[model samples]
Target: MLDKVHDLFRLRTSPVIFFVSAGLIAVFVILTLVMPEGMASFWGAGSGWIYDNLGWFYISGLTIFLIFLIIVGFGRFGRIRLGQDDEKPEHSDMSWFGMLFAAGIGTILMFWAVAEPANHFAEPPRGESTGVEARSMEAASEAMGFTLYHFGLHTWTIFALPGLAFAYFIYKRNLPPRVSSIFQPILGDRIHGPIGKSIDIFAIVGTIFGVAVSIGLGTLQIHAGLAQLFGVSDADWNFIIIIAVVTIVATISAVLGVNKGIRRLSNFNIWTAIALLIFVLATGPTVYMLRGTIEWAGVYLSMLPELAFWNDTLADTGWQNGWTIFYWAWTVAWAPFVGIFIARISRGRTIRQFVAGVLGLPTLFTIIWFGIWGSGVFDIEFNGDGGLVDSVLEDGVETALFAFLAEFPLAPVTSAVAIMLVGVFFITSMDSCSLVLDDMCNGYEGKAPLHQRAFWTVAIGTIAALLLTATGEGGLAALQEVALVFGLPFFILGYFIMYNLSRAMREDAGEVGFLRTRRWLQTLPPEEYERRMEEADASLAEAVVAPDYAEGTQPENAPELEHAEQPPVVEEYRVRTGETPIIDPANPGDTGIPPRG
Candidate 1:
């Protein structure tokens, strides 16, 4: 009976769904373009408000800092050595780390590798835009610097922190593989049940919402590139088209299983992506690219604090809110699926090595990609008469990228290869999502049954296309809100994992007995060890509770809030009899009670 119910509820996710998705898009596009003022204006404004107003950035940054402490706490003090004997999970041939890590971050990286640099170059940042306009080297470097900040160390670091926390909890602590699982060690066993499942549902749902934006934005850009570059005309719903092809391929790959299909796909995508970056770096502009690299690096290093944790609510939040906060939330929405994906992959690795590799290595690649792609754009701006930047502005982001390369040295070949690069990225992301959404729906441990992953992948893409057509840019706007809601709690969970893990490790690493000889650890009274552990527990709590923000102290106003001190929202009201009741402004739905009505 239960199986029958599950089958009924499960989405059919067929070609008909795609056809329905397309019809919806057509209707939505007509309405959106016709009523541009209403749909576009409000969504853009609300997005801006939520973008700048929300306080999640501070919360995410704080968790990142706690992760920093955890890194130090684990290595500087060493650990109890949970002998690396835990069995690794049965997964696809693809290195768990490679497939999951690259897929979640790779597609965006591909798009940004060239597109973002160009996007920022055309309208270099005002904060960094100084001196003469077009001819200035400083202006170009400023553009590259901003993109790197968005994609580089800090942004990806946000992704990795949650991954590390989640991995440690699941693999080391033996908890279920859920976002809330990180808190179970601290919150206790109940987190594995209904309460935890609710949290997982929210995280999973929020993640898919975020991924919907990824599919829509990414699909639109890639499809538009195909249309503009090769003149693939008559493709109204190019994203849905791309989704169909990629989902089919990934589904087949998923069926052969992870090791054969997913890993191969991830590897191919990674290498092709690298080749694409190399093509840009080698063929584009060398001198400007190299020079921009130095300047952006210096600027990013100097302004790291400001860029990573700016929370001046009243200041003109141009980049901070629109770009910085938005990306943080975006990554956070991704935290549940992607973070778990990363943690699942990393095993047999040390605490320090895991943290640094996950946090630092990819960042290095992000910086370079930003340099290569962004520098290419800057070169065109300062050197090659404003052709590329101009084209990008005139022809939209997708066409602009296609047009820029067509004018380059290897025009025909590069454009064709560019298509390949786009395909790998888009498809790789599709397959990865298929795997992720599948597992998320089922238990988040093993590779989801192939048929299931394929079904949801198709469903996710279809929904995104429909929403994109109907809501247009609002779809992207709503996708961001998904992150804002989930990023903070997950960030907090990351910190708890760190704190609890620290305590667990302290006992494990012989810290409690480090002072004692081995003989003492064994011979010492159990009562003495219990008393010491209790003392450690009290100390741990105090150490972990970050102070409230004040002008003088941190946590107080730091972008990375060490701790949050928000008072509970209270609902005050009076219930009345059948008499008409006045709703209080402070508490709506409140019924005013009359003395003896």
Candidate 2:
């Protein structure tokens, strides 16, 4: 029994990464506990420094990521599959999009879909400079437009860029699914060195804090919903209990693995969210929302370029810092967690497919989501009582959604659904994040031991609960700022990832040439052609891993190659390409091609 207990907790991870990440997180929690006021002030000062100095850097970096992904997705690299040539996507399209939507911004959309737009409608950014009167038709239009901007393509691009790099390296290049592995093209063998470990450490810590902020936000939102529905006291103990219960559910889901737990919950979240959205649209002013959605989409697209690059430089209103800059930083902080999770489920997809699904689909859903909720709130403010805005301003953003729902029919039912949706979203995000954290810690070898995932889930929940109990909303906001500060490094790292991915893809393109018709090859016997295609895919996979083999190394946690049935394909590939394929005897694989001299 003791041995089994030990086995459950045993980890296949670098001591440096595991201990350092835990140590940093422990110190953060301790500091927050010991000197909550000082830590909050420190985080405030750090946030101010970043906002003053690096606000434009964040905006420009996100814009570059969007442009780079667009170019790569639509350009020649779009044709490159993330995995072997013949590999097909593991999850179906519905499940894939479901997971993406659930993990990307489900909880946030719930929390802010109505609150943000209403706030903006009350006081538009740059209203003084633009001469847009607050709460005017113009302000209403700009409000939804900005909501779409914050939740749209540029935001998704943060996740997409890292997801693309991770997918390419992990699925195609057979590198371990670590942030540092994407840098392998540039770093080579040094990816296993201190620099690589340092990158992973940052990823782990960033992921934790980022997810903790979300957990904190979700808990607060849940508490607000409970208070509204049941008259529950807004006590810290209640918040702790909420975190504890949700963490337990998330831990179980994490242990169940992606297919069984995460995927199902994600599908449920999407469907439930859709039902709730339809409830609003159908029961409320359906025509207005439908028509407004089209108009808002156009408005969003028209304003995207301006909004994407706007840094409040000309006006100097400090508005962008609180809104646009904060959103960008928050998304950057979330990139590692969301990116890796997206990458894990995105194997066997083309770059174009990944980008289109990650950026396009989510953005479309977001536009509709905000369109329904934003337009609903704006309609009430415009035509009905203007109390929705007052509710958001006075009652806090957490209660805004429920308060909005209360103005409609079946307020109780819709509010309950909304709360349920938030809870499920909370669970899905936590489970997915915990899984990603486990992967990073174990170097992405395979499914991590269940205890390790449970540990992360507990740690995240405890941190969130402690932050909530200790410093309440102020501390949560300060911690979120610190998460953004951590994101600055990732923003810098994004450029290097883009460079490395492009260089690696360019090299591969040079070797393999571009996608072309194989009419002559197809004229052969069907079985023969199939065999040839399989051999080609095997050869491509080998080519990707050949460099590591040449250097007598393998990525940490990479699976050993098995040679039981792949020799003929390698020989066939060698004969056709007129290139020698070296085979490593120690790690023999029928499909494994070794380093070419």
Candidate 3:
């Protein structure tokens, strides 16, 4: 009985990672519960210091990641398959994109699609420099651009670089599917030592805090929906209840594993989100949204350079701290979780294909999502109906989307759908996060026990519930600060990961030469390609040695092979004869090579 209990809870691998991370999170939750104000103040101060000192680093780091991915995706190394040279992708493109969109930023988009743009429109950034005043046409245009800037390619690139590294290392090289595995090229054996353990620890901790932030946000939005729909009061107990229910659902989904649970939920999330989006476009100001979406793309492209690197050094408006830096920090914090999750599902995809799907498709979808939603809110605010912005600013940001929907027809029905969307998005994010946490804790071996996944799901929900209940009015702010603080270490870790991945790819390219014709090789008739390969092999065989040599003996002209290593001969024999040598396990001394005919 005791053994069963121990087996149920024990982490078979990387127990240190599990214990230390669990301990730290336990301590944090305890302190927050004991003194919520103190913890909140500490997080706030820590967040401020990071933003003031390292905000520029955050901005510059993400920009560099974006540029690096673009170059690698289109560069010569693009043809390198993440798995074997001939392996195909595991999931279909539709399911792949669904998981990517659902895991990466689904909840964020749902929560902020209406609120962020509304906030930006009400108060545009750099009015002194860009001359885009608040609540004007210029502000509205700038708003969508900034929205896209925050949620677009730059953000996805953060996830892409890490995902690419994980896939390349885990699938191609057969490394363990941990964040530290990406460092194997540089760390070598040290990856299994204290250094590697430390890296995984950071990943686990950061992923928890990052995921808790989203869960907390989703909880808030869920509460707001409930309050609107069923007159549920905004109480601490209700928040806990919301988190409890969602966590239970997420745990069940997680226990069902990725294909059975996460993939289906993700597909449902995308379809439902799209249905809601199309309903908004169809019901309200269709032409304006259609036109604004095109202009939004242009404005995003035009302003991307400035927004990508904007530090606000000249004026020091402190705007970036709350918006850009916060979003970037949230994204950085999410990198390991989303990166690992995407990499887990991205087996057999080429680096170029992974980059294109992970970075491009979701970005395009985000632009359309925000364009329609942002256009709706902008139209409302611009027409002298300030209720949506006022509710967001005064009432609460969580209620912004429901309030915006309230303006349209079937307010109750659309609001219910929005609530359901947030709930499912919540479940998908939590379940995926818990699964990744399980992988990180267990060193990415076979499936972890179901209880382990459930434990993580519970831990995440507990942290989010504690933050919301303890911090009271400042719960969301505290969640953001936690994301900002935990994100810094991982953000710094990303550079090392990038360096290691690039160096390894370059070394691989040198060994294999350029794989530019890898795809072209596929275009040829299989018979033709096989014939050409056979002819080339025959020529190489002649240049080396005659293929008539008996097993365990050298040909007369190859006398230099007398002192040469033995394994290369075996390899050459196999390549020439198209047969792998098999040794008898019982005999121990019998060479498995057959006598030449």
Candidate 4:
């Protein structure tokens, strides 16, 4: 009877959901093209408001997370597994990983790079004025550092590990695959019911909305490019048509599956982005960027302690909240989608690898970015009126990038590349978010089908358009609020993971888990290091399974006897070939292998 009811519900509601999702995206493009910049700002103001209210609450929380990463990152939380069968997943090469991972960062990264430096160049943070002597360089350099500081290593860590935990726990421990699966230690078998479904569905919807608007972010850049290059009217229907065509192409690429199309596209995008960076680094006042980068590093490092922990309570306390807490909240809002997306690709990677990757790679890129572009542009600013940066602040992201580009040697060529890079970056991000949301809808975990992926990817943009219409960007703001609301509570898991990570390491290694100990895993060679991770994972999975999985907690369609017949007839799921390396039960896995097989 329940099966009949579920089938009926799925039949009736599925079509409606898909239809509504599709219809909204087409309308969103139409409306957004016609929507005034004032509306975007009105919505963006909400971003400011969040900054004003609970910004530091997030920063302090993130500060604590940094500590957790340091404590657990060594080797404790490494070696996560996902999936019931010990099947291996296909992984990208180093280049692919670099590119794909980079894609999750939204087009906002490109838009902000130009816009923010401009804003700071005019009125530096802390209300510092740039006199004729003060020069915009000082202001711009400071802005870059702060931006990098926030988005750098610290932010990605928060977004990534939760997915790692979820995927690893579900796949390896034989627990239900859902966001709540990570909480099985707390929720037990209850992780399999309505609450779990809601959590997964909510994550799906939230990510769709998030990525949808994010796709829309590229619209502005595209408009900017068109307006500047072809002298096309950004406000006209032509712009919308162009965006539709471009976005469709990107969506199609996603439909081609992760390893083939998405992977190749990301690989290209990251390489070009890096090429752009290298171009600037090599030609853009190399000496100044190097010196300024060192200073930025010092400021970043010295202030790192303060930057992570600052919760100012004094006058203009609003300033503290606006930036810090806003970032934290924004980070949380971004967490589920980014986490899930990263987690999907992160199979075969250990928790240590994930934490380090999230916390290290992005930060490295950000620092180099600030050092190169941020410092180079600021040097130009210091020498003159800093008009490039000034325009970025007064105008918008598009104009700012153009204005800054004008200062370089091959301004026109680089500008073209920058324009291309922005669009590519947006699409890469779009596909990634879409893929993550599809996983949410699959009602199973890990690699979902390409068809579901394409549907959700395009659906996300459509929904964002509609929601943006409904909330007038207030919807986007609302999404941020939702993220914060969801994220603030997840701190418990972060804490629990951190605590367990530390305890397990200490006990396993006897006295060696202590940092001062000679056998700290960090000191091991790469091969030996990995062996240790396998062992640790096997051990942890056993402990986790007895309590969490020892209970009957299979999903309705999980390939267990209960529902093994109904193997999620996915029209477009991917099976990663090499990454998921099944632990051979014949060998009973490494000493640390989980009970996934």
Local distance difference test values of all predictions, in order: 0.55, 0.79, 0.77, 0.54
Q: Which parts of model 1 have CA positions greater than 4 angstroms off?
A: 1-4, 7-49, 59-70, 77-101, 128-135, 311-317, 474-509, 512-597
lDDT of predicted model 4: 0.54
Tens-digit per-residue lDDT, 1-597, candidate 4: 533542554421223233444444455345444554543455456655655665665666667777666556665334432332334544744643554354556455667665665565565554432232234445555566567776676777677556666555544444433465555445444444456555555554444545554555566666676666678774435544655565676688777756766677777877887788778778778887789777777767775765666555543535555455655654565567676667667665555666777677777766766666667667776665556755665667657666777777798788788878777776667776666555444434333444556665456555444444444545545444444444454544567655543443332232222121111001111122233344443322222211222224333322332111111211012121222223343553443324223
Best by TM-score: 2
Candidate 4, 114: how far from true, in Å?
3.0
**Strongest candidate by lDDT:** 2
**Whole-model alpha-carbon lDDT for candidate 1:** 0.55
lDDT per residue as tens, model 2, 525-561: 1122233344443333233212233222222333343
lDDT, candidate 1, 1-597, per-residue tens = 443444565532222222333344345345555664565555456556666556554535654664574555366543322123333344433454456545567767756666666766556555433442433565565666677777766666666666666655555544445665555435454453456556666666666666666777766666766776567664446556776676567567656655677677777766666786677777767666677676677777776666555554444536566566667666766666776666655655555656666656676767776776676776666666767776676766656556767657877677777666666655666566556555444433452344556665666666566656655566555444544555556655555656765554443233243221010001111122222233332211111111122222221221332222211110112221222123343443233322222
- Give per-model TM-scores: 0.72, 0.86, 0.85, 0.73
- Which residue pairs clash in candidate 2? 562-589, 563-589, 563-590, 566-590
User: How much is the lDDT of residue 243 in candidate 2?
Assistant: 92
Give the Cα error of residue 437 in candidate 2, in Å: 1.0
Candidate 3: tens digits of C-alpha lDDT, residues 1-597: 433444576634455777788888888777777777777798999988998888899888889998989889888778888876778999999899889977888888988988988888888887777787888899888888888999999889889989998887766655666787778666654555688778888888878888888888788899999999999997789999999999999999999988999999989888888998999999998999899888899999999998888899998999888888888887888799899899989998888898888989999999899988998898888764667887898877889999999989899999999998899888988999988887776665344667777898899998898888877656556666777888888888778878988876664443334342111101111122233233332222212211111233222332221221223433534333332224333442344334445
RMSD of candidates 1 onward, in order? 15.3, 8.5, 9.8, 10.5
**Model 1: which residue pairs collide?**
80-508, 80-509, 92-258, 92-259, 93-258, 93-259, 549-556, 550-556
- Candidate 3 residue 45 C-alpha distance from true site, Å: 2.6
Worst 10 residues of 1 by lDDT: 516-525
